[model samples]
Target: MTNALTFFEPTRTAGLERLRNFAPDAGRHYGERRNYLGTAKNPGAVSALSPYLRTGLVSQSEVLRTVLDQHSAKDADRYIAEVLWRSYWQGWLALRPSVWDAYQADLKRLHNAVQTQSGLRQRWENACLGQTGIAPFDAWANELAHSGYLHNHARMWFASIWVHTLELPWQLGADFFLRHLLDGCPASNTLGWKWVAGIQTIGKPYLATQENIEKFTEGRFAKVPGLATQAAPIPAPPHPDRMPLWNTGQPDPALHSGLILHEDNLNPTHVLDAAGPIAGHVTVMATADQTPWQMAPHVQAFRGQAAQNMQNLLADRIGPAGPAVTSALALKQWAQDHGFAQLVTADAPVGPTKALFDAYDRLPDAPPLVRMRAPLDADAWPLATAGFFKFRKHIPALLARLS
Candidate 1:
C-alpha cells in the first residue's frame, strides 16, 4: 500500500476493460474491502472506474448492468449504491443549482483573499503544497496532485481534516480538489466538501480522528496525531428550493446538424442519436474554468486525452473534429465555420462546461445548441428531492428501467 495509486488509460476501451476486470468483485467482495485503501500496487476491491464515470466514458447504468450480470442486486447492493451516488449528487444539485452558484461566489471572494492576505495565503499554500507536517494529510495532498484519483474513503477523511483541523474555508478545499482530481465535478466535489463541513446535512459533520484513520488505512497512518478532536458544523443557509429538472432536449432532425463534444460527455451516443447525422463534430474542454487557480497537469492531461479519444471514436459518424476550443466564441466559430443550422451535444451538468454554454447562449443569433440529457439522468435526477436515503427507494425502479 506504499505505492501511489496509478491512473488507468484515459479511453473508453480502457474504461470498459476496467469494468470487466472489476465485475467479478462487484458484489460481496467489493462491499467487504471497499473502504480499505491498498495503494497502487496492492489496490483494494473498489472499481476505480470513476474518471470514466465522471465523463460519459462508461455510464452508471452500463456499470450497474455489468455488475448485475455477474452478481445479484442483493449481493451487489453496496457497490450499486456507490455507482448511483454520483447520479444522486448530480440530481440534488440540478434540483437546486443555486447551491453551485453560491459556492462559486464564495470561491471568488476566497480566491482574492488568498492573493491579498499574507497569513491566509501562507496557510493555504502550505496545505496545497503537502507541507502541512501532518504526515497522512501531506501524503494524500501530494497523491491527489500527482495522481488524478483518490479512494472515496480517503477523500472523506481528507475533506474532514481540511475543513476541521485546518479550519480553512470548505469552498477552498473543494476548489483544491477541482483543480486536481480527474473525477472532480461540480455536484460531487462541492456537495462532498459541504457534507464534510456539516453544511449539506445541516448539523451532521464528518470528522477525521487518528483512531479511525489508522484502523481504516490498516495502520498505514497509525498514530496520525493532531487532527481535530471535535467537528462543529459550518454555518450555512437553508437548502435552496427545488427547481424542476430539465428534460432531454429534442434536436430538430430536419436541420443541417453538427455535434459538439466536451469533457462533460465525450462519448455522446445518446446525443448523436437524437441529432441524427452530424455534418461535423468539434471537441471543447472547459476544465480550466472549473478552478480559479491553475489546474494540476494530471487533471488537464487525463481530460484532454479522454476527449480526443472519444472524438476519434465518433469520427466516422461525426466526421473529422475541428480544432478543440476552450471559449464560447470559439464554439460559435465552429457552428459558423460548418454553417450547420443547429448544433447539439450531451447536456453538461452544472459546472464549467455549462458555463461555456451559458456564455454561448448570450451571443447574438448563435445556432441553437440542443443539449440532450441521458434517459438515466432524466429519470433518476428528479427523484433526489430529499436525502440519499429517500432516493434509495427509487433504485429498483431505476434499475428496472436500465434493463
Candidate 2:
C-alpha cells in the first residue's frame, strides 16, 4: 500500500546517483519547470533528493557543490536558492527557538478545541480525509496521505486552502503534514504554514486561486470551484528576537566517550573525524514523538532503515553504534551501561530530537552530550538573523566558503 518504498531508495548511493543524474539539468531547465506539479512518480523539475537531504544522507554542501560544478551560480540561481532555503529555515528556527516553543503550546491549546467542538471537529476530519469536495485541495490531501510527499507548489496551495478557504486552524494542517511528510522539518512545515496564513510575515497571506492551480498543475483540474480569492492574516504575537548561536561542542578525546548517533545527521563524517576514537555508540529515533497521533508507517520505516544503512555503511568508523533507542531515558540507561564520561553527537536543530535532548540535559544523572555542529551550519546560521532576502544577499559569500 506504500509507494514510499519505490519513490525513495533510502541509501546514500541512491542519493548520489540521483544528484549526478539531475546535475545536468540544474541550470535554466530547473528554473523553468520547478513549479510545475507533475505526478509523484515523475519528479518534473525537482531533484527528488529531499528525503535524502532531510536525513543528512546527502549534505547540502555536497549537493550545492555538485550543481555548481555543472553550472555557474548565475545559471543555477533558482536551484541554488531552493537548496539554501532548507538551511535558511533551519537557521531561522535555531536562532529564534522560542517560535518552536510557541508552536508546541498552540498545538496543545488547539487539540482541546478540536476535541470539544463537534462542528469544528467534523470540518477538520473532512479536510484531512480529502472529503471537502474541493477538487484540487482534495487531490493534494490525498496525494500527501498516499505518497508522503507533495510538490513544493502543491504544499503552498494546500496550506493556503486549508487555512483560508476551509477556514481551519493552521496548526492542525501543519501537524497533518508533519505526521505524513517524509522530508518534513519543524522549521519549513510550521513556518511555511504560518507564512501562508500571514503569521510569519504579518498581513501578507498567500492566496490559492483556481486559475493559478490550473496553470501549475498543467490543467489537471480545470475550472476548479470555490478556492479562496483572498486571505486575511492570522493574529499572533511577533516572533522572539534573535539569540546567539551555540558554538560547536568539542568532544574531549581523553574522556571515555561514545557517539550518540541519531536521525538528525546520519552521515556525520565531519563529526566522527572531529570526535576522535569512540568507546562505542548507540542510536536514538524521535520520529514517533513528532505527533500525538500515529505516524505514517512509511515515515517510520524509512528512517529506521536509513539508520541501518548508515550503521552498515560506516561500520568501521561508527564502531559498536547500533541498537537504537527511542527516548531520553533509554539514552540515560545506555550511558549507565557504559558509564561513559561524555557522549558525542551531531548537533540537533529545533525538532523532536532536540526536544528529547533538552529533556536529557535536565536529567540528574545525564552525562554531557557534546553536540558537534558542522562548520557549514556554524558559518551560515549566523547570517540568517534577518529575513531571507538579507540572507540571500550572502549566497555568493556562502558558496565561496563551501570551496
Candidate 3:
C-alpha cells in the first residue's frame, strides 16, 4: 500500500468527497473484484473508505444511502454487508463488554511476559518488525508499518500467520495493528483477531493457505511456504449473556448544557438538533485511553487533529469553545466550571471513548451526561443479538427504512 498519510486526510470534507467518488462502484463491480489485492497506489476494487467510516465522519447509513441512490439493494448486497459487518462487531461487543475487559487483562499479562522471556520478546519483535522468515508475512508487516492500512484479505492472512504459524500471542498481534492502522477500532480490531483465532465463532478458524494467498494476490505472491494447514479452535468461555441496550437520553431544553465532541462522532448535527442551545463546548481526546501502552505517535496526532477539525467545523454552534482535554476528571471539571447542568455528547459505541465516558459518569459530583446515539445505531444495534447471518436477515428491511 502507499503511504497512509497520502490517502487519508482525517477530515469530514475529505471523507464525504471520497464517499461520493466511490458510490458508483458500490455494486456489481465491488462484488466481482473486491478481493484482489492491489498495491497501495491502486488498492484494487475496494472502497478504501474505512478511515472515515471508522471515526463516524461518514456514517454507515449515509454511505448506504448514497450507494442505494446509484444502485439497487440487490446489486449492492455484498458492499452493504461489508459495511454492516462493522455494526455487527460493535453491537456484539457492546452486549458482551466483558470480552474487552478480558482482552485488556490478557494484554497486561503478555506485556509482562515479554519483559522476562527474552526469546519470546525477540520473536514478537521480529514478527512486528516484519523480519520473520515468511516472505508474504514479512511484506505485510512492512506494508502495515509503512501505510497504516492493509487490504482486509491481507489482515486475515497476517493474523493467521501470527496465531497459527508464528505461534505468537494473538493480543500482541491485535495491539500491533491497533497501534498502526488508521482505521483501527477497539471492537472490530479485537473481535477480528479473535475471529481469526477461531474464538469468536467457536471452531470456525480462518486459515490462510499458500494457494489462497497466491490466488488472492493474483500471483503477486506465490511459492509461499511454512503456513499452518489446519486450525483448532482456541479455548474460550462461551459468549456472555446479552445485556439490554442503553437508552439514549435527550438533552433537557431548559437546562444550561455543554456539547462535547470526540473522535467517535465528529458530526454532531443530531445532537445540535436535539439540544436547543449550548452554554459552552469542549473536545475530548481519548486515543490515549485505547491502550495501556503509549499509542503510536501518528495515531495520537491524527485523533487530536481530527477533534480540532470538528471544533472548527462546529464553531458557530459551539459557544465558548475550549481546548481539548484528556481525562475524565478534566472533562467533569470543565463541565462544572462552565456552569453546565448537563453535558451532552454523541453516544460512543463500545470503545475507548465509551470507556472514558463510563469513567466520567462514575466520578462523584460529575455533571449529568446526556448521550445521544445516532438513528442508524439505535435501529441496527438491537438486531445483533446473534451472529452476522442471523442479524443479516434484516438488512433489506433496514435499507428500506433508510429509504
Candidate 4:
C-alpha cells in the first residue's frame, strides 16, 4: 500500500485549503471528537495541519483568523488553544534556550550510549523498529515511521510507554519522533517529550493506562497489557528564569538586502511586504542540522520540497534566487556574492534554523543578519513566560490584537 503520509501535500496552497476545509469543524465538532485516534486512512476529528504550521507554510495567525471567521472564540476555543500551544512552546524554549542546549547534549550522550552499550542498543533498536511486543505501542511505532504523523492522544500514550513501560531513555524517544514526524518541531517535540517524562512541568508525568488507550482508540487497542501503572516524574533541575525575547529590528529599506528563506519559515511574503524590495534571494536547507544523526529520508525530502514550493510561490518577489545552500559559509558567500549589504529573513524560533542563523551571525566578516519576526509571534511569545494555563489566559487579547 502507498504510504499514508502522501495524503498530505507539502505546499502553501494545500495548507491554506486544508485550513479552510477544517475551519467549519474547528468549533464544537473538533472539541467533541479531537481525541479519537483514527487511522491514517481516517484521521478522525482533529485537523492535521501541523506539518504546514510547523514549517511556516501557513502562519498561526492566518489559521486563527480563518477559524474565527467561521466560529466564535468561545465556540472554537479548544482548537484556538491548541494552535497557541505551539507558540507557547516556542516562546517557552526561546526564553530558556538552555533547555534546548541541554537536550542536545543529552541526545549526544544517549546516542553514544546506544552505539556502545549492547543491551541498551537492542532495546532502543527494538522500540524504533516496532518490535516492542506491546500491540498499541508497536502499532504507533510503525505508524509514525510509515506515516510521519500520529494522533495527539497516541503521541501522549506512545511517550508514556517509551519512558515508563519500555524503560527507555526519554531523550532517545524524543529523538525517534523528531526523526520521523513530518511536523516534528524542536520546541514542541522536545518540551512535549519532556512534559510526558514529567521534566517540563515537574512531577506530573503523563501516565497512559490500558483502559484510557482503549477508550480513545474506541476499543481498537482494548485489553492492552504490559503498560506501566505508575508514572513518577523524572528528576530535573529547576527551570531557568525567563530571558527576554530577542528583539528583531525592523528591516531597513535603504540597505541593499537579500531575502534568505529556510525550512523554519518557508513563506517570506510577510517579510517581503514589510521589508520592501530586495536585491536577490537564497534558500537555505538546515534540516540536516536538526540532529547529529542522519534524519529520516522522508523528513529531509519533505522540507527540501516545501522550501522549493515557497520559492515557486514567491517567484515574482524573489530576484535572481540562488540554489538551495546549507552551512554558514555558503550563506555568507551567497550574501557577499550577490552584493547584499544585509540579509533579512523571517525570524526562526529556537531550533536548527535559529542555530544556523546564530552561527552565521558569529562568522567573521559575515553580512548583518536582520531577522523579521511575525507580529503574531512578537505579541504571543512574550506571554509564554509561565505555564500554558497562565499563557492561555491571554489568548483572547492576543486574538484581539490579530484583528
Candidate 5:
C-alpha cells in the first residue's frame, strides 16, 4: 500500500487516462472549484496526479501540455497555477537553502525536547497512531495511515491542528506527513509545514477549527473537542545570497554518460534519449543520509523495480550500477572505475540528491555533471524569483514558449 505500489495498479492507468480524457473539463472545473472539498461521500474534483508524477510515470510538462491543448488559457489558468505551485516551492527552497537547514536544526532540537516531556511524547504518539480523541483529526490521521492519501484541505487542517492545537513541533508533524503521505515531497513538505507554523509567511500561521473543518468536509466531521489555538512562532530564516548557477559545462557528445537516480528524478530514460551515443550507463540510487524513517516495503520494492526498468531500458546501451551504495567515498570510487568523465541525469532540485551532487560537483577532479532540467521547471523557476502573482503573469508567455 505504499505510494510506489499504489501507483502501477490498474487504477493508476485509469487515472492517467482520466487526465487525458477529462483534462479540459478537469482544468476548467479545477479553475473554479479547486478549493471546495465536495463531500465525504465524494472526493474533491481535483485530479489526483501526484502519485504518478512523483514516480515519473508522467512528467509535469506532459500533464500541463495535455491540459493546455484541451482548454483555453482563460479557462485553464487556475489549474495551471496549481501545477506551477510545485515549481514555486522548489525554486523558493532552492534559492533559500537555509530554510531547509533551519528546519533540520529545529526538528532535531524539538525531537530531543519531546523525549524529555512525557506528556508531549504521549500526545505525539497518539497523534501518530490516530488516537487524538478528536473525531475529524483522528479520521484524517487514520486516512493517511490506511490509504496513504489525504485531501489537500485535510492536510492543511491536520498540519494546523498538530502545530497550533496540539502544541507539537511543526517539523515532527511535517516529518510524519512526509513519511506517510504518498506525495510526500521535500520542498512542499518542508515549506508547507513552515507555512502552517507561520514561519514561511511571517506571523500568519494556519489555524484549524471545527467550524471550518465541517464547512469544508460538508459536515462529514462535526464534533471535536479540546484543540489548542496558539502556534509556536518561528522566525523566517534569513534568505541566502543567490548563488550563480554553476556552469554544468557544455554537453559533449563524445564523452560517455553515467546515471544517478535520486528521488527528484526517478526516471532516466528521457535523459538517455538526449545523451546521444553512450559508451555506458550506470544507474545509481544513493539513499545515504535519507532519513525518512522506515520506508514502506512497497516503496523499497518499487525502487528495485524502477532500477530494473531502468536497466532494461538501458540494456543495449550499457550496464546498471550494482547494489545500493550509500557513501560518497564509494560513489567517487565507482565513477573512477567506470571511466565516465561525464554523468548525465535528470535534474534533482533542492533535495538530498541535489545535495549529494553539490558535494560531488565541488570535487576538483569529479566528472562533468549534466542534469537535464525539466521543461516545466526550466520555464517556471525564473518566474519564481518573486511572488506567485508575478509568476502567474508569465504563464501565457510561458506556454507560448513551449509551443
Candidate 6:
C-alpha cells in the first residue's frame, strides 16, 4: 500500500477493536480482496492484521473462531485457508530444521564473500538502497527499508530481484528482509527466500518478469532491466544430520511463575494457562544484531510496546510492572529475585533467539524452563514431516477443525 501504516499501530487501536469489529465480515471480504495494497489514508481491503498475528496480540485460533462464528464453513473457507498458511510454513520449517542451519551458514559465507567482491558489493548496496535500475523492484526495496512491511506479492518480486538480477546469495536477501520487515520472521522469511531460490520447491523458483510486475503493481512500475529470462534450479542443501526437537516436559502449574516474552511467539494467553495463580511477569527482547542495526528505531518502539502490554496485563495479578530488560543476565536476575520457580515462554522456532537459548553453557542456573507450542502448530507439525503439498492437503481438514 502507498501508506505504510499497518493494522498493528496504536492509531488503528493496535487491531483489538478492528479484529473484534471486522471478524464477522473478515471471512468473505478478506478472502476476496486481502491481497490488495492500499494507501495509508485508506487500507480497507486487507485485514492489516499481520503485525498482531506476528505477535500474539490476537491468537490464531481466536481469529479463526471469530470468522467461523460469523460466516459458514463453506463461506469462510478461503479466509480460513489463509490463516493456516502461517501454521503450515511453521510446521514445514520445524520438520526440516536443517533449513535454518543452512541459512545461517550461507549468510555468513555471503557476508564474507561480498566484502571481497567490489562489483557484487556495489550491486547489493544499490539494491538495498533502492538505486537499482529496476523501477518496480527498486520501489519495493525502498518500501521495505522505509516501511518494514510489504504486500506478500511484492515480497516475492523483490526477493526474485535480489537473488536473480543482483545475483546475491539468497540467504543475504533473506537476512536483509529480516533486518527490516516488522513482521520479519525466521520461518516465513527464510523459507520464502528458499522458495524463490528454487530450493524450498523442487525445481521451480519465482522469477520477477517485467510483465508480471507491471500487471500486479497496477502499472506503478514497468521497467525492470536484466530480469532473469529463465529460472535456475538451486539444489536444496542436504538436511542436517539431525534436527533438535524441543523437549516437551510440562512444569508444575503451582510453581511461583514468571513469563519470559521473546520474539519467537508473542501471544502467551493461550499457551500460558491461568490455571493457577501467576506470580510475576517479565518481558524480554533479544535484539536481532546479526546484521547492522538499521531497524533500531522500530525495534526500540516494539520493545517498549511489548513491555507495556505485559506490564498492564499483569497489574491485577501482580502489583506494578516489572522492569523491561534486554540482557539475559538481567532477565535471569529478575526471575531469581522474584523467586520464580518456573519460567514460561513460547517455543523458539529457529533463529538467533533459538541459538542463544540453545547455548546452555552461557546461561545461569535458571528456573525450570517451559516452552509452549500453539495448538494449531501442535496439529500441523505431524503433517509437515513431508512437503508443502502434503501440508496443503491438510488445509481443508485443518480449516474444518478450526472452524
Worst 10 residues of 1 by lDDT: 1-10
lDDT of 1: 0.86
The 10-residue segment of model 3 with minimum total lDDT is 1-10
lDDT of 1 by residue, 63-156 (tens): 9999999999999999999888899999999999899989988889999999999999999999988989999889989887777677888899
Q: Please report the TM-score between candidate 4 and the true structure.
A: 0.97
Say which prediction, candidate 1 or candidate 5, comes out ahead on TM-score.
Answer: 1
Q: Pick the candidate with the highest lDDT.
A: 4
Runs in model 3 deviating more than 4 A are none
Worst 10 residues of 2 by lDDT: 316-325
Candidate 4 lDDT: 0.87
Q: Candidate 4, residues 3-42: lDDT per residue as tens digits? A: 6348667888888988888889999999999998965557
Write candidate 6's Cα lDDT for 1-403 as tens digits. Answer: 3223332462224656767776766767777766555422344565556666766666678888787778887787777776777777777777767677777777777788788999888987898888987777777787776666778778888899888777777877887788777677778888888889887775778988887777766677666667988776565655444344566446477777877666655556644664246676666566454453354356446545755665565467543346765566776788789988877767666666566555522585876667777667777766766666677777767766764
Score residue 72 of candidate 4 by CA lDDT.
Answer: 94
TM-score of each: 0.96, 0.97, 0.97, 0.97, 0.87, 0.87
Per-residue C-alpha lDDT of model 5 across residues 1-403, encoded as one tens digit per residue: 5343443332334446857755867556786666666322244677766655665655677778898788877788787777778888887776667667776677677677777999888988999888978787888887776555577888888898888887777888887776665566778888888788887777889988778877767777776667666666765655566654334433566776676665555555567677766655544554324443554454445445655664565577655554454555556667788888787777776766667777777777877788877766777775667666777788778778767
User: What are the lDDT scores of the predictions, listed in order?
Assistant: 0.86, 0.86, 0.85, 0.87, 0.68, 0.68
lDDT of 2 by residue, 38-76 (tens): 656788898988888889899989999999999999999
Clashing pairs in 6: 3-40, 56-267
Predictions ranked by lDDT, top down?
4, 2, 1, 3, 5, 6
**Model 2: number of backbone collisions:** 0
lDDT of 5: 0.68
